[model samples]
Target: MGLPDYIPVKGSITFLGKDITRWSITDRAKAGLTLAWQLPARYEGISIRDYLRTGTKGCSERDLEESMDFIQMNTTFLDRAIDKSLSGGERKRIELASIYLMKPRLAILDEPDSGVDLLALREVLGLLRLLADQGSGVMVITHREDVAAGCDRSYLMCDGRIVLEGSAGAVKRYFMSQCRPCDGCEVGEVMRRG
Candidate 1:
């Protein structure tokens, strides 16, 4: 995905056998590619239902219900605004639910497990698998062991570049070895200030 105010030094991107290396974000979207960012953006005046309706044009009530169910969301949230009023978990779930309904040709999920619980994480994985099985390409960028392990292959990215690419187990082991807590760092800090 292209980041705003920054251009890729060098890279080639192809989606569904089409070269999209120089395509704009709008163009990629028009070609059925979508990205689910790690931090879901909030919409000040948009309702959850309205936001989700963008996933599928003229979305029916039953389809929306099914999508919400797939993401383990309560249908009553339809009227809620897409803003800070919602919890991080709730926002993340809505984003995933939208992705589920979008049915894009390629869905790039960045940290799908960031704000989700065990069950929601499982649902996210299931959604990716379902998408792949249905002829869509799903790419998940996650650091969680369980999440990465679900993939057929995995790539370890370090310093904004790939350091390893192989079986999920191999990359997972390498990632763990390099994940221990260290002094003068907060990578694994979990306790409250004493």
Candidate 2:
């Protein structure tokens, strides 16, 4: 689980039950699984409409046009130039919306709340929990304590291996205690901020 056993120098990965060890990034994306980058990836000459069309098969317009509360409302400003215009949080949210469009069985999000605000962070966490509850397996990799707290279960990866795992609360407690002399510094901040 340590970054999903990546071999960066080789640019290969295997996810879930799929041996994507040889699949291209796009191929992996089309296989009922999706990955959101640690930093949101943006398209240069694309509008949100154009981008969504590519991923969603031109269905976003039909669906969003008919309903108002979906991606449209959530991605209020994404319809503009998607190149270098979006804030990190906005781009991340748009990335999440794009992943939602795929209706994937497994979603791998890398630090989805990297630069998001409190409200947006909560929204993302709530949506992730909902996805997991709805029978989608969500694997979120983050160093943020708040993000870990939102997950149903938690695991700690150190030195390229999973060293600790358990309920989220238990993991948090253990992580907090191991930080030494400043038990309050790690978990206390998480509790206080939450």
Candidate 3:
């Protein structure tokens, strides 16, 4: 999640009240900063359990079982390799499961609602809520109207900048009136109004 290019270009990233703008991705992860990517990378031969034990602290089988249950995955997932065989939704849930095991202080999710069905979308939202309830800060990068509306606050980014920030309803209304009519917008770009 801490890829070099992903570093902020303007403002700094403060986590747990500490400035982490200069920290390496590895350093950030060690400090309880975790992310679940939308298009999770495939690990051709890594079993789920082995991959998690390497990435998460205290990731014993028991922890995996508990985390898997949170994501609605059965224990059988532990034995499967995180390869192309698993669907995108499965991979996204598994990544979230790994993040849950980390008990991260802040969780950054990138369009987690993308490429998933409605039922899975609910699981993703529930996981975000659970992380927030656990005292972890949750930052979601999403375009889904419902997902953004479920947040306490929301930001609307345009051209790599935050064009609007407020309650989700306000941002959605503004986007509809201001951005939705732009000729450059992809037909699929509008937030799916809930």
On lDDT, the candidate that comes out on top is 3
Give lDDT: candidate 3, residue 56: 65
lDDT of candidate 1 over 72-181, digit per residue (tens): 77888887777767777677778878877877777787777777778667776776677677666777776566776777777765444566777778876776787554
lDDT string for model 2 (65-127, tens) is: 332233334444446778775667567666766666667778877777778888778877876
Candidate 3 per-residue lDDT, tens place, 83-130, comes to 877876787788888788888877878778878788888887887788
lDDT minimum window of 10 residues, candidate 1: 185-194
Evaluate model 2: give its lDDT.
0.63
Candidate 3: stretches off by over 4 Å = 1-11, 180-194
Off by over 4 Å in 2: 1-18, 58-60, 64-68, 71-78, 83-85, 178-194
Per-candidate TM vs. native? Answer: 0.76, 0.73, 0.82
**What TM-score does model 1 achieve against the real structure?**
0.76
Query: How much lDDT does each candidate structure score?
Result: 0.71, 0.63, 0.74
Total clashing pairs in model 3: 0
Q: Which whole-number lDDT from 0 to 100 does residue 77 have in model 2?
A: 48
What is candidate 3's TM-score against the reference?
0.82
* lDDT of residue 90 for candidate 1: 75
Q: Candidate 1: deviation at residue 68, Å? A: 1.5
